[model samples]
Target: MSNLSQLLKESWVLVEERHDDVAAHFYARMFLTDPGLRQLFPVHLDTQRRCLVEALVTAAASIDDPERFTEYVQGLGRAHRKFHVQPSQFAAFHGALLEALRTVGGDRWTIEYDQAWADALGLLTSNMITGLEQDADPAFWHAEVLAHERRGADIAVLTCQPLQHPLRYQAGQYVSVEVPRYQPRLWRTYSIANAPRPDDTVEFHVRAVGAGWVSSALVRRVRPGDLLRIAAPMGTMVLDRESPRDIVCLAGGVGFAPIKALVDELTRFNRSRWVHVYLGARHRDELYDLDELLRLAATYPWLNVVPCCTDDPSWTGEHGEVSEVLARYGPWHEHDFFVSGSAPMVRASLRTLAELEIPADRIRYDSFGDI
Candidate 1:
């Protein structure tokens, strides 16, 4: 291993057990150093702390692989841009992080360990700065909500029109949305729910999760003519139309957003390749877009839609988790798989597909955090 990787791993091992405390210290020191920076984040620091710990651990573990580590850091940097992260902020964050590590390490810290951490942070932050510089699109787009349809009590489908310039994105990419009501500056990423439209319009499926500030505002407070700011599209879940392989899409709950967009893209070209979709929800009532799926399936003979319910006993439709339901359909060996939903669902689906011998390269997914 390189000196940078070895040092990071060794140092992280000492701090791993007290990661939460370290993260807490890092933020505390950060705000104390620059009090104004505190306003940039949410009031609750628990989730942010967890994210920082996870990121540090992941970076340390992956540091041996230069290409993968660089890609990961670049994506991390791009995601941070949606929050209006500035290049000038990197140094303060780096210093605070190093201080946290030293505070946690106590006598365990040495000059060598400090140098390694500084080097590692320099690499990560430099790449992040490069990522920020690479983006040519506007920081945010102004979109007017054209219509909002409540699919269920907790789900809303928003149709929006960009007010200034067209928002360019692939079939299955997501955009970070900022709603005015919830925590003013907080922005959340939601996958685009349809293929690119001729009118440059976009759709998003927002499901209100418990204590989800932006989602709750989008689904409960957003109305027609309401203006919202959207960051440039992010994510690489888009379909590879060049591939001749058939597709198997596994979607759970609101994870259907990007999967639907991919399927819609395929149907538009009347692609002869067969596409199978396994959409699941906890209750039949939660399968809010069944009609839309059914209509698309009918319109495209090559596409098959299977709806599954995990907890609804009264429903006569296929009953089981989407991954379990997928086992009934044989031979996914030749097909590419797209899995999305809550993190548990995605992890489960990936494990199942791996067991079925589907190559990892052929699977595409967008992690939706804990949703």
Candidate 2:
């Protein structure tokens, strides 16, 4: 490992527990330094604070892996384009971040740690700026909502037509969406729920969570003819055609969106591949796409659909959490595992797969709901 990478990891531990306070301090310093930048962020800073901490920790954890870190930073850079981030702002943000670190580290802060963090942050910022400059796609795609169907009380399926420059994305990739109803620049991510269609239209499945701004707007307020701005697709959860292993997909709640897209592509091009999909929900009603999945299973003999429901006494189908269900159907060592859902569900699935002796490299995940 590089001296800089090692120093960052070592220093980060000292302030890791104080992340919330650090994030608050960083934002306060940033907005105080440049009040103009305040409008770029939401009034609510809770999610924003958590996102910053999680992103930094994740990047720190990957410092030992240059290739992985580079990809992550580049993708993040491209995504930040939609926020209208500029080169100069990177330095301003770094300054606030350093102050926050120093404030949190206190007695542990050292010249060596400062220098290491400076070098590391400089490199990461440069990569982000370079990625922004090299990105070929527009910051956002203008799309017109062509249709919307409420799957249940909270979930809605939307079909849109990219007004121009339709995004070219893998079946399992997700796009960040911006709704004008909320704060002007407020954006949230929703998985592209289907494979590319002949009409160049894309689909999204949104489930409104309490107090979720974008989800609420998408599920209830947005309608046909409404215009929505969408960021370029970003994610690494797409299929690896090079691998011939059978597939096992674990989806929870509305997490089935991307999995549905993957299944669509697999059924269309790789009909012979054996696939098992375990869809879980709190109850029967939440399995909104069960009928569609069952329809696909009936048409594709190589595909199997298992719906698992918990917290429902009247339910007669598969019962238990997805990981438990996966455990009961043991010996997943040979399958390529794809997991999408709540953070807890994803974490449990990973742990379960690890306990079953599945290699880490064989598992893929995408946990960002609408970040």
Candidate 3:
């Protein structure tokens, strides 16, 4: 029997050779045939095409055990439900994906070759559908920009409102963000700053990265009343309320976005649970919601807030990167630790926590891939 891994590797070769280029052509075909789908994507076709290609590449490369891969694909399918993506929509994506495949398959593009590709996509999309059903459609999301305040030199908080009776999402969960100017419906995952329920608006605290398309557009151009495109909120960086352990939340810069929401949820029940938050920034001005955090710290005698600054010329507080500050103060054990931040921040803190012999199972993190 041929190994599924070998078959997938072969599929990847065909996919890799011209995945990007094929994706472009496929979307061109899609737009012509289904202008409706075109409306779903950004004005820039190349960019949208890349995201679809990138999503699939990431999906393909993630396959290790076929059983697990099927499960993951199902999860993606379920996740896309909020997009209101139909079975019909998959046809267009499938055509584009396969057309890209044929071009890359070159001499190996035979009958059996075509069949294998078709079977693979069928399995993948089918699993996606199953996953979607399992999660169920909580409710479709409607996007509204509620407030836009320039918090720092380049960072801003843009609060968004969800549809009435919106689907429930956890803290640290992010949605695919779509801005009109960029093409291909770019996916920038922003943590849900507000907890689920009661309030209908999901907030994202965005920081401009100079070259960042979404963040810059949000800080400089986006207005409170303006409407923007967004996908359904979904992510695993959430607090499992059922898990009744003490929680430690650490954030670096905008990583505070998710952690803040999480703390709110923790406070609702574990009013007496030890919830310690260590938030850091380059300067005091860079701190988002400093007053709010301190207030939480004061109110919950068990919850303490430690704000640190690493780069101010007049530096005081816990002076250093957030991770360094964390290891020094925490020999914290038997607690759930959540860290969300820039790649380096998350990586360094994970190392520090491990070196301190914090159990690997207790730590959770949110990290970005590529840019």
lDDT of 3 by residue, 6-94 (tens): 56567677657677777777777767767788656545555456556656765665555577577558757765764567777777777
Candidate order (lDDT): 2, 1, 3
Better of 1 and 3 by TM-score: 1
In order, the Cα lDDT scores of the candidates are 0.86, 0.87, 0.73
* Best-fitting candidate, scored by TM-score: 2
Which ranges in model 1 have alpha carbons more than 4 Å from their true place?
1-18, 57-68, 105-117, 369-371
lDDT of 2 by residue, 1-371 (tens): 77877898899989989999899999999999988889888778887788788778877777788888888888788888898888788887889988999889999799999988787787788888888889999988989999999988999999999977968899889888888755467777788988887788999989988888888888989989999999988888889998889999999998899999999889778845799999999999999999999999999899998899989899999899988998999578888989998888899888899889999888888775533
- Model 1, span 228-261: residue lDDT tens: 9888787768888788998899999999999999
- Cα-based lDDT at residue 42, candidate 2: 74
Worst 10 residues of 2 by lDDT: 180-189
Per-residue error for 176 in candidate 1, Å, reads 1.6
Q: lDDT at 214 for candidate 2? A: 82
TM-score of each candidate structure, all chains considered together: 0.90, 0.95, 0.75
Error of 1 at 232 (Å): 2.0
**Which 10 consecutive residues of model 3 have the lowest summed lDDT?**
178-187
For each of the candidates, give the backbone clash count: 0, 1, 5
Residue pairs with clashing backbones, model 2 = 189-370
Instruction: Give the Cα error of residue 67 in candidate 1, in Å.
Output: 4.8
